[model samples]
Target: MDNKNRYSISDQSIRFLNKYLNSFSPTGYEREGQKIWKDYISSYVEKIVTDLYGTVVGVINPNNSPYKLIIEAHADEISWYVNYITEDGLIYVSRNGGSDHQIAPSKKVVIHTKKGLVNGVFGWPAIHTRKSLEEKKPNLDNIFIDIGAFDKKEVEEMGVHVGCFITYPDEFFIMNHNYFVCRSLDNKIGGFIIAEVAKMIIEHGIDLQFGLYVVNSVQEEVGLRGAKMISHAIKPHIAIVTDVTHDTSTPMIDKKIQGDIKCGLGPVIGYAPSIHKKIREFIIDTSKNKKISFQRLVSSRYTGTDTDAFAYSNKGVLSSLISIPLKYMHTTVEMVHKKDVEKIIQLIFETLKGINYSKEKFFID
Candidate 1:
């Protein structure tokens, strides 16, 4: 079979993706999820290195090539931090990484505590009890967690206190066998794609002339903290960053403001200040040659993903962004198309196969 035919998503991969996506990996607390990811990719890579902040790197063809290349994704997910526990045992929260306040009401949550997982629910008054015109919406101050505690002292006694990390209790599932839905797809899917690409290259016995860094970064929900630090340390010659973009085809999103990205179309290639022209063209060419479908996006200033972090780091490495179009990003029901995921994996794998120093070099002449 040819390389294209040989690369296929197996049942084991789907199982891994489900497990990894279901795992909680809130910002600054990504160690557990990172361990799961590292374990999955361990047998497929030659060596692995971890940073002080827990950004995991699986190295391919390590120490054999001077040129370094990176295919990266952030592992952290948007979550909430317990800001204050009221005297009546209601828990007010703050954003951990752009956690959407509007979606909090009536949702189930897991508050990570010293004891273990504490179940809670975001409480809201029934619409019938409130004046429709005067009804307040779910916001930072209004949304609170009810864990069945009667008082603040009981809440603390139950191991729930300020600074505890909170995440939606939503698990991964397929919709109509086409859409992958769950919280945190903004980036756990990115990590999954890179891992799949690495698996394909290794299982097929494909040799690379340059080093490949499969990076699962942390603190992206807070900022591009992990990517910033790791890019400087690795000093890679080229970087390909992947993350989720909004599927504007969904309701309430204006296509004029957000462009016309959709779930089932394909992966989206971004044009941004951080994107290197030659690298961008090469990726587009690879997509065309391999017959992989893709969409286009333009970012005026920044891509707002780790692409900026890696692109501007280490005296400016050549970098570009490829995004998986997702619906309801940052919400518990975030969804993506299965075909886009597979195509992205193929695009990255094929692009890497075509990168030869003698044939194509990064030059600005």
Candidate 2:
């Protein structure tokens, strides 16, 4: 495809990403997100299935191959849940996943209550009321959400119940020429990439030697729970875990510590023990041969992604991580490059075509 066509595809994917990010589908509350993903991906793939935990699994080659190839992207995003309602109508909430408390205060949010969606803003004590020492980072527990209700009874009447999901009400926007910012790009972007790959595979009719399973998992931010379950069930010979990594463009980040991955470069091919060396080599070689821009990220220990879960699942699976370099991870305004997103989709499609499942050794020696 030409550059213009490739950019068009990326732009379409960005639209999908925005819609998914804007929806309220945090952690345990993933039904809405799943419905959206299902509706978009159902007609493109050969078959689709939803697991017990609401993980959406799309199968392109289900019957022929002996080995299964599982690609995972979690559907859940970081969010909060209502914990208490004060007599004055203020709602106290507890975080559901890995959320930066510092960014929560003063941000607009949507509470997915029993009756309907109620808009609110995270509120905290003013700086003027705090002592000099207390002006430092305050605890998240002290934060509350104000929805303009009169009292606790009024708030309850508005259908704000305990355990209702609360998420950042941020919309996706293009920052510069190539960079974009939004909430929940961490794995929503990953899910969008997987779906885009599936669409390409279907349109091109690429012959595959192994069965491919594109799984949109749930609750990865908490502890990779969805990956653990799906990997165990699929028991694939090989797996690819897709997620986001730090861009480190802002101040206070050490370049040497996080390697040289950046937002506009391309997707970062992960190098870790859990990642099969042969698969990593195949991906790198394919990117080079295809003349696609790519970057390398080294992880000395376990990568904090679904790869960690898939590595040890069942008897043990050979798993690798393909990360999109993202700035401001786990925040309301996460940023990613549009080129990097397209590169990741191409890399994944090309890597799958290069797999040699009949080999005896797992890693290339």
Candidate 3:
């Protein structure tokens, strides 16, 4: 069997993708999701190392190589924190990590509590009762969730309280045949792609020149906290961070502001000051050489992804960002093209196979 024919995404991987995306992994709380990711990639890696705050790294060719490369993605999803429980047992929430209040109304939610998952729904006033001219939009102050509790006492009895993280219960599904739709595909798709890259390396029997660290970072929805801490711990020589970028072709999004990107157009490569110019060019070259389709996106001072964290780490790591085109980011219906997902996985896989360099030589040019 030919190498390319034998090595492609399998049914097992699709099953794992569905399972991983459906699991709750809110910012600052990603242990369970990380466990699922770690277990899936364990067979493909030489050894696995986890940090104090639950950043998981699957180290390949771990011979204490001075030159290390990292392929990373965040595991956490945007969520809401139970900020205030009203006397009527209504829960007002605060942003856990860019949670969209406008879309919260009528969506199903799961509040993570010590007692396990408690179901709830963001309740809104009936249109018949609201005066159109005086209607208020859903904001942090107005959006509330009802857990069918009549009063605060009932809510408390159900183990609901302030500071509990709430996530959407939306499961992964295929849309219009080629798009992956779910609530947190903003970055969980990234974790899945990195794992697929690892699987490719193992099945193809590719020998790596550097220690490859596949990192599933936590707390990215809040900030680049996980990537920041893990960068210091790994101190990699080169890093490729994958995340989601806006698909401005969708309705209501201005292409002039968000950049003109579309789903299924291939992986999007970010250009920013934080991205190392030398390594960025190397990745572009690799993509061209491999005949992979990719789009370019120019960013402001910071790329606003984990790339910034790794790029500005100790002594600076050569980092780049590869984003998948996503529609309706931060909403329950976040979507990404399946082909774009495959492109990113292929790009990273081919780049790793071609990166035969030392840290000293990388900085020379």
Off by over 4 Å in 3: 1-7, 358-360
Per-candidate TM-score against the hidden true structure: 0.98, 0.93, 0.96
lDDT of each: 0.91, 0.83, 0.90
Per-candidate Cα RMSD to the true structure, in Å, reads 1.3, 2.4, 1.8
The ten-residue window of minimal lDDT in model 1 covers 1-10
Q: Per-residue alpha-carbon lDDT of model 3 for 138-219, expressed as tens digits?
A: 8889999999999999999999999999989889998887988998897999999999998899888998888899999999
lDDT of 1 by residue, 1-365 (tens): 15545456789999999999999999999988999999999999999999999999999998888899999999999999999999999999999999989989899999999899999999999988888776788788888999999999999999998999999989999999898999989799999999999998997788898999999999988879999999999999999999999999878998887888998888999998999999999999999988889999998799999999988887988999999999888899999999999889988998999898767866333
Looking at model 1, how many pairs of residues clash? 0
User: Predictions ranked by TM-score, top down?
Assistant: 1, 3, 2
Q: Candidate 3: what lDDT?
A: 0.90
Best by lDDT: 1
Residue 350 shift from truth in candidate 2, angstroms: 0.8
Judged by TM-score relative to the true structure, which candidate is superior, 1 or 3? 1
